[model samples]
Target: MPAFDIQTARFNMIEQQIRPWNVLDSGVLDLLASVRRDEFVPPEHKALAYADLEIPLPGGQYMLTPRVEARLLQDAAVQKTDSVLEIGTGSGFLTALLARRAARVLSLELSPELVAFAKSNLQKAGITNVDVRQGDGSQGAAAQGPFDVIVLGGSVADVPHKLLDQLKIGGRLAAIVGDDPIMRATIITRTSATDFRTSQPWDCDAPRLQNFAQVSRFTF
Candidate 1:
C-alpha cells in the first residue's frame, strides 16, 4: 500500500469538502489547515480523518464531519478576547479550534472516558486555554456564565433555553437542531436580555446529544 500524502489530503478536504460547504472564513480556514485533525481522531480511525465522514468515538458518539465543524466555527466567529462554552467534547477537535480563537474555552462532556480522551488530545497539542470537564453539558456551566460564544458539538431537538441564558447579550450560539433524516444548522444571537434572533443558514445531520430534551411520543 502506498503511504497517503497527509498534506495533500488536508488541502483537498478544505478546498473540496469544506470550502464548497461555504466555510469561507479566513481564520477558520487557517485553523483547519493548521490543526492536526489526525491527532485528535482515535488511532483506529486516523486514516479517515479527512475523509468527510463522522468518525466514531468510544461512547457511540461521533466527531462531526469536517465541513459541519468548519461551518460551525465560521458561524461562531470566536474572537481572541472572547470566552467560549462548548457542549459535547467528543474528540476535542472542535475544542482545539475554539481554544485557538477564544481567550478561554470551557468544554463539557457527558462521559468520563471522553473527558480524559479530550484532555489528553488537547494537552498533546499544548492547548493551554481549554478546560475539559465531565458533566451534563445540557445544563450549561453556570459558574462560568455569560460567555461570549457557545457551540453545541452535537444536534438537539431544540436549543436549550438554559444554555442560551448562559450567553451574554450579543453573544451567539451555534447548533444543529431538529431530528434525524434532516436537521438545520442554526445560529442564535442574543439581541437583548430577553430576545434572541435565530436563523437556519444550512442543513446537516448530526447524532443527537445525550440527555437533551426529546420530543414526547404519542400513542392511541
Candidate 2:
C-alpha cells in the first residue's frame, strides 16, 4: 500500500474535522497547517494523527482530539504578549499550540516520563517557547504566574480556585470541566481583581488531568 499522504490528511483534518466544529480563525487554521501533529504523536499511532479520536499516550493519558484542541485554542484567545500556563502537558501537542500563540508557555506535567517525552517532541517541532516542567500542574504554577492565560489540557471535576487566582486581571482560562458523560468546555475570564465571568462555549470530554480534584461520590 502507498504511504499515507501526510499533507492530504492534515488538510482534511483542518477542513473536514476542524472547520465544521467552528474553528475558523485564520491564524489558528494556518498554525494547524504548519505544525506537524504526526511528529508529536507516538510513532505507533502516527497514522491516526489527524483522526478525530483521542490518541493514547504512555501513562494512560490522552492527546485531545484535533477539534477539541483547536476549539480550546480559539476560546483562550491567546495573545503574542501573553504568558500562558498549561496543565497536563501530555505529548506536548497542546502546549506547542499554546506556545505558538502566546509569548511564552509554562506547561506542567506530573509524569516525569511525559515531561521528557513532551520536551523532546517540542524541541523536535521547533517549539522553543514552551517550558515543559515536571510538577503537579493541578495546583498551577504560582511563582512564574500572574499569567495572562491558563489552559488545562484535560478535564477537571471543577476549575481550581488557586489557578483562577494565579491569573492576571483580564486573563482568561479555558478548561474541560465536569465528570464522565457530561463535560463542558468552559472558559473563565478574570474581568477584574475580584470579578470573573464564566462561559461554556461547547461540550466535550477528555481524560482527566492526574492529581486534580475529583467529586465525592455517595455510597449506596
Candidate 3:
C-alpha cells in the first residue's frame, strides 16, 4: 500500500469537507490546518483522522466530524481573552482548538479513560491552556465558571438551562441539539442577566451526549 500524504489530505479535508460546510472563518481555517488531529485520534482510527467521519472513541462517544467541529468553533466566536468551558472532551482535539482561540479552557469529561487520553494528546501537542477534568459535564462547571464561551462537544436533546446560566452576560454557548439521525448546531447567547437568545446556525448530526436532560413527552 502507498503511504498517505498527510498534508495533502489535510488540505482536502479543509477544502472538500469543512470549507463547503460554511466554515469560512480564516482563524478557524488556520486552526484546522495547524492542529494535528491525527495525534488526538485513537491509535486504531488514526488513518481516519482527516476523513469526514466521526471516528469512534474509547467510550461509545465519537469525535465530532471535522466540519461540525470547525463550525461550532466559528459560531462560538471565541476571543483571545475569553475563558472557555468545554463539555465532553472526547479526544481533546476540539479542546486544543478552543485553547488556541481562548485565553484558557476547562474541559470536563465523564470518562476517566478519555480524560487521560485527552490529557496525553494535549500535552504531546504542547497545548498548555487546557485543563481536562473527569466529571459529569452534563452539569455546568459552576464554581469555576461564568465563562465567556461554552462548547458542548457532542449533541444533546436540548441545551440545559444550567449550562446556559454558566455563560457570562454577552457570552455564547454552542451546542448540537436534537435526536439521532438529525440535529442542528445551535448558539445560545446571554443577552442580559436573565435573557438568552437561541439561534440554529446550521444543521448537523452527532451522537447524543451522555446524561443531558431530554425533552419530556407524553404518551397515551
Return the lDDT, model 1, position 193.
95
Per-residue lDDT of model 2, residues 1-220, tens digit only: 1235988899999999999999999999999999889989988999899999999999798999999999999989999999999999999988999999999999999988899999999999888888889999878989998999999998999998999999999999999999989999999999999999999988988989888878888999
The segments of candidate 1 whose C-alpha lies over 4 angstroms from its true place after superposition are: 1-4, 217-220
| Residue lDDT tens for model 1, 59-87 | 89999999999999999889999999999
Model 3 misplaced regions, further than 4 Å: 1-4
RMSD of each: 1.6, 1.6, 1.4
lDDT of 2 at 53: 94
Error of 3 at 185 (Å): 0.8
Against the unseen true structure, what C-alpha lDDT does each candidate score?
A: 0.93, 0.92, 0.93
Show the lowest summed lDDT stretch of 10 residues, model 2: 1-10
